[model samples]
Target: MSLLTVKNISLAFGGPLLLDGAELTIRDGERLCLLGRNGAGKTTLMRVLNGDLPPDGGDIMRRQGLRTALVTQDVPADLEGTVFPIIASGLGEQAALLEEFHQVSRSLQSSTDPALMERLAQLQKRIEETGGWQMQQLVEQVIRHLKLEGDAAFAHLSGGVKRRVMLGRALVSDPDLLLLDEPTNHLDLETIAWLEDFLVRRDKALMFVTHDRSFLRRVATRIVELDRGRLSSWQCDYDTYVQRREEQLEAEEKQAAEFDKKLVQEEKWIRQGIKARRTRNMGRVRALRQMREERRARRERSGTADLAVQQGERSGRRVIEAEHISYAWTGQPIIRDFSTTILRGDKIGIIGPNGSGKTTLLQLLLGRLKPDEGRVKLGTNLEIAYFDQHRGQLDEDRSVQDNIAEGNDWVEINGQRKHVIGYLRDFLFPPERARSPVRTLSGGERNRLLLAKLFTRPANLLVLDEPTNDLDLETLELLEGLLVDFPGTVLLVSHDRAFLDNVVTSTLVLEGEGRVGEYVGGYEDWQRQRAEQIEDEEKKPQAAAEKVQPQRPGRDRPRKLGFKEKRELEALPARIEELEAEQATIHEQMANPDFYRDHGDEVAQLQQRLEQIARELEQGYARWEELEALEG
Candidate 1:
C-alpha cells in the first residue's frame, strides 16, 4: 500500500532548482535510504515530503488519515521539557491536558495533599472527557519502547539519548511514515548497532538520509539518490547500487558526448554559409535553437572533493609510548593500566561507548592530559594536525575563506601558494559559499572546511576525533583514501565501521572497567577475535571443573584424545592460517575499484566465503585450545 505519492514536484530557491519535477511513491514497509551530496537539497526534499515545506509546483497525494512524522537534522534549540510532555506533545490538542495530568499525578505520589489529589482528579476527568486516554497510553508506550525515562529532563540527556527522545516524540503519534535526516550523526557504535537492529525489526516505513554506509546497508530496503535536481531510485543494496550507478553515469557521459558532437556538427553547418539559412532549412535552424536551450539547461553532477594531506618532516620511529597509564575522573577509573606504543605510519582506531573515554584516551596519548599514575612519551619532530569532532578548531564568526586563510588572500599547501577561493573550490565550495560565515554552513560543509584548514599545515601525526561525522559517502571515502596513503601516523576516533575497516591497521577498544584491549585489524576483525576470546573464557571454567573433580571409582581416567582428534588439534594452526590467507586474498581482490565492475557477481560469494572462513577459523582455534587444556 502506498502511504504517500509525490508527482511532478518542483521546488526552487533564488538559484538553481532544488527539485525539478521530482516524483516518488513511498509505500508501506519500505526503508528507503536517501543519498546525495551535502548541498543537493536532500533535507529540503525530506521537508517537502513531510509537508513542512510547500513545493513551488506539483501535487502530493496522501492516503486518507495517513500520519507522517519527521525528525530533522538538528535538534531544535528551544525544545524543552521532560521526556513525557515532549512526547505527549505529539498528541495534538490534548497534549496540555495530558501533561497537566501527568504532573499532578506525579505530585500526588510524593505529597498526598488534598489539593494535589483534587487537581489530579480534575485533570484526569478532563483527559477522559477529551478522549485522550489512548493517546496518553501511546505516549507512555513510546517512552518505554525507546527506553527513555519519562520524567527525565530532555536537556540532561546525552546527544544520542536526546536523539532517541526526539525519535520517541515522533513515534508517539504512531506515524505511518517516519523520516529521519542524518539519524546516525552523533551515535556511537553500540547505539548505532542497536538502532540498526531496532529499525530493522520495526514494521513501519522509514526514509532516512545518512552518511553511515554500514547503517544504510543494514537498514535500507531500497536506495534513492538525489542528483542534479532529480531523484533516481535503485532497487538494490548500497554496494550493488554503487556498481549500477557507476555504469549509469558512464553511459550518460557517452550519450552526452554523442549529443555534443551532433550539436557541434549542426553549429558548423549553420555557420557555413547562406545555403544553410535558406527557406527549406528554417526548421533545422529552429531545431538548433532548441538544442542550444537544452544544452544550456542541463545540470551536470557536482565534482568530488579533492582532498590531500600535507606531510611534514619524518618523525622518530616511535611516535607515542604510554607506560601503565591510569586516568580517573570523579574518582572513577576511565583508563587503567593501559599501555601501548604507537609507531610512525601506523593507523589506529579508538572505539568505545558514548561516555567510555575515547577522547580521554586520545588526550592521554597526546600528552594533553596528564595521566594520574603513568607517563606518556612523545617522539621528536611530530608536527600534529588534529581534526576535532566538535569542530572547535573552526571559527564560526569568520567566513569560510577567512577561516582558512585568516584574512590573507593566499594560503600555502605543501610549499606552494594557492589563492584562498581556489583552495576552497577544491573542497567543492564556490566563491559565494566560501565567503559565507562558517556558522551558516551545513554540518558537512563545516567538516569540509575543517579538513581544508587542517591539511594546510604540514603534519607528521594526525589525530582525528570522529572526523567522519556529517560527511557524504564520497567525501568520506576520499578521506579514507587520504588516510590510507598518509605517510604519517594516524590516531582516528570513529564509529564508522567501514571507514575503520578501510583505513585502520589496528583497533583499541575500551571495554568497561578501565580495560583497553588492543587487537589487530579493524572493527570486524576485533569482533571475530573478541568472540573467540569470549568463547575461550566461557570454556575455561568447565575445563577447570573437570580437572579438579574427583574421578568415579569404576570410571577410567578421562579418555585421551583419539589419533584423529590429535591430528586435527595439531593441524588447526596451519588450517587457521590457510583460511586467514584466503580471507586476505579475497579482501585484496575486492579492494580494487575495478573489481566491482569486472566481477560484480563474485562479490556476494566472496563475502559469504569470508564469513565461512571466519567461522571455521574461530572453531578451529577454539577446538585447539580445548584439546590442549584437556591434555594438560
Candidate 2:
C-alpha cells in the first residue's frame, strides 16, 4: 500500500517553475534516494512532501492517520536544552508532561523533599492516564541506540553529534515515512558506516537526498532524480541507474535534434514570400505555430561544471618532511612521535574521527602550527592552495563575483585573461547569481564557488579539507579526475570513502592514543592492511603457546612446570599489577591540564614508556596462562 501519493504537484518561484506537474508514490518499505544537480529543487521537493511548504497546485493523498518526519540538512539554530527533552519533544502533545516527569524524578534522587515527591507522583499518574509510557520508552530507546548522553546539552555537541541528535529526534516520532536531506554531510567514516547499517536494518520507508555515492548505494533500494522540474524514477541500483540515465540523456538529445531539424525546415518554408503562403494549407500553418510555441516552452538541461586546476611551476622533488613530530592540545596528544616524508606528486589522504585532530595534522604539515617536539621542514619553491572545510576563505557578505575577482571585472588564470562573469559561468553560475551575496547560495553552490575561487590561483600543492561535503556526484567525480591527473602534490582530508579511494595515493590514519599509521593505498586498502595486522597479532600468542608445549606421539601425561617456571609463574601477577599501576599513574598525570604546560618535554618519553608497559603486561599474562595449563 502506498503511504503517500503526490499528483500533478506544481510549484514555482519568481523566475521559473521548480516543480512542474511532478508525480510520485511512496510505498511501504521503499528506500528511495533523490538525486539532482546543486540547484535542481531536490530540497524544495522534500519541503513540499513534508507539508512545510505547500505546492501551488497539487493533490496529496495520504493513508489514513499516516505520520511523516523530516530531518533537514542544517540543524535548527533554536534547538536548545538537554538531549532527552529535545528528543522527547518529537512526541507532540505528551512532550511537556514527559519532560516535567523526568525532571522531578531526577530531583527526587538528590533530595527527599515532599513537594518533589508529590509532583513526581502526580506527573506519573497523568502520564499513565494519557498512555504516555510508550512514548517515554521510545525516547529512552532512541537515546540508547544513538549512544547519546541524555543529560548533555544539545548546543555543546559537535556538528556530527548534533546531526545524530536531530536524527534521533526524527526517529523517536516513529513515522511511517522518513525524509532526510544530506544525512551524511558532516558524518565521519565510522559514523557513516553505522548509519548505513542502521538504515539498512530499519523497516520503514525512506526518502533522502545525499551526495555520498557509497551511502546511496548501500541504503537506497530505488533511485529517483529531479531534473529540470521533473521527477524521474529509476527502479535499479546506483551503478545501473548511472548507466541507464546516460543512455536516456543520449536518446533524448537525439530526439531533440530531429525535432529541431524538422522545425527549421517548416520555418524556412513559412518564411518564403506570398508564393508559398498561397499554397500553404491551414492545418500545416497551425502545426507550424504549435511547433514554435513548443520550442519556446522547452527547458533545456543545465550544463555540467567546467573544472580546471591552474598548476604552478614545479617545486623541488621533496615536498614536506616531518621527523618525530608531536603535538598536544590542553594535555591531550593529537599526534605523537609521528614521522613521514611526503614527496612531490604524493596525494595523501588524512582521515580520522571528528575531533580527532585531522585538521591539526594538516596545519602541522603545512607549517601553520608549530609542533611542540619535533620539526616540520618544507621544500623549496612551494606554492600552496588550501580549501578549508569550514569555507572560511569565503566572505559571506560579499557578492559571489566580488569574492572571486575582488571587485575586478576580469581575472587571469594560467596567463590567460577572461571576464569574471564568463569564468563564473563555467562553474554553472549565471550572471544574476554571480552578482548575489555568497550567503544566499546553496551549500553545493558555495562549494562550487570555493572551487572556482581556489582554482583561479596557481599552486604547486593543493590541500582540500572536506571539499566533497555538498558537491553533487558529477562534480565530485570530476574533482577526483582532476586531482588524479594534477602534476602537483595534494593533501586531502575527507570523510567521503569513495572520494578517498579514487583520488589519494596514500593514507594517513590517526588511530586513537596519538598513533598515526601510514598506509600505501586508499580507505579500503587501509582496512585490508589493518585487518591483516590484527589477525597476525591474534595468532602470535597461540603460535608461541603451541611452540612451547609441543606434543610427542603416544604421550598421555601432561608436562609439569620446572622450579624456575614455578617461580616465574608466581611472580607474574605482581609484575602485571606493577605495570597496570604505572599505566594508571601516567593516565592520571596526562589528564591534568597543567601536565602538558609544565612537562611538555617529557610527553613523548612517557607515551613511549606506557606503550612498553602495555606490551609487557600482555606477554606476562600469556606466559602465566601457558604455565598454568601445563601444570594442570
TM-score of candidate 2 versus the correct structure, residues matched by position: 0.83
User: Taking the tens digit of each residue's C-alpha lDDT, what string does model 1 give over 79-170?
Assistant: 78898999888877899988886676555445536565455446645666687766775676556545678889888887768877887777
Q: What is the lDDT of residue 304 in candidate 2?
A: 80
Candidate 1's C-alpha runs over 4 A off are 91-109, 114-152, 155-162, 546-632
Every model's TM-score: 0.81, 0.83
Output the worst ten-in-a-row residue range by lDDT, candidate 1.
Answer: 550-559
CA shift at 359, candidate 1, in angstroms?
1.2
Give the clash total for candidate 2.
0
lDDT of 2 at 146: 64
Whole-model Cα lDDT of every candidate shown, in order: 0.85, 0.86
Tell me, by TM-score, which candidate is best: 2
